[model samples]
Target: MPCIPRLSAPHFLSIALAAASFGAAAQQPQLSAVDLARKNACMACHGLVHKQVGPGFAQIAERYRGDAAAPARLADKIRNGSVGTWGRVIMPRQSLVSEADAQVLARWVLAQPQQQQPPAR
Candidate 1:
């Protein structure tokens, strides 16, 4: 028969606390940017990797990669929609999404990785 080592009370308490902490973290909202976008119907016009009615998220990230004010600027643009940037396509003002949520979404978009280019042959 194999003898199992019994854990000390402190060790058990620590393990239980760690697991409980992880459970709390898991309970916290972990929705991704894409999920938020979808929930707010932004996916109707934009996409993560490809263009639909508007430019894709990756393209937007590439366009604003160097600008330090991209997050704030994009957040404003989201709250108050504009035209002529991508084309004549009109982005209606997003009144339903809260300003804080708009900023969160904008930050998420800005944090997206730029599209990778193919290596030279």
Candidate 2:
């Protein structure tokens, strides 16, 4: 059998540094399909966690939770940006997003976990 080489202190430190760097990178959340859509300027109106000129992403998730048909309904709404649910906030329809993009975005959005704010003290 071949003898195993021992690692020196500096070699061990380098290994630790490399592992730490990789761990930090892995801890970051990946951009979802919808995130790309948002970065493409879809969020000029709609927001991720809070309400802006448009309804909040959390609000949409809440409104459609458990609805089997919400994906289709939301996809249509995004494609057209029609108003009525949240009120007169006209959702200026997006022609920039494609049908596939709409579907991917809808699924990613609907799949997001809901976050609640703490009661104001």
Candidate 3:
């Protein structure tokens, strides 16, 4: 006969609580720059508000604020980098994103207002 270890009531409750906490955290939409940067590999080539190999999110946001279609367009440009946009340091097209991911990034970028915003006229 094999002896099996049983979980105590306290142990089970702790596990349940941990699981519930994780579930709640997951349910909360990660509409944050930290989350976006960590999830999308932004740190690989770009910093939060500084210049890395590429421009930062703040620069992008400041450049495209108040334009409704700007988010969609920026997302598309991220997936497909352009020339002469930021000097000759061309950003290569990222092949690891979906439209949904792009939208998330775009929304996150647009949400940041730490820098200057475009004219409201």
lDDT of 2 by residue, 64-109 (tens): 8999999988888778778878888887787777777777778777
lDDT of 3: 0.78
User: How accurate locally, in lDDT, is each candidate?
Assistant: 0.89, 0.80, 0.78
TM-score of candidate 3 against the unseen true structure? 0.62
lDDT of 1: 0.89
Error of 2 at 85 (Å): 1.3
TM-score ranking, best first: 1, 2, 3
Return the top candidate by TM-score: 1
Ranking by lDDT: 1, 2, 3
lDDT of 3 by residue, 1-121 (tens): 9998899999999999999999999898745646755776877888778789888878877777788999888788768867678788787776586677777787787776676457899
lDDT by residue for model 1 (1-121), tens = 9999999999999999999999999899857777779888998989886789999888899898889999988988898998999989888899887888899899988888878888999
- Give each model a TM-score: 0.70, 0.65, 0.62
Q: After superposition, how far is residue 32 of candidate 3 from its true place, in Å?
A: 6.2
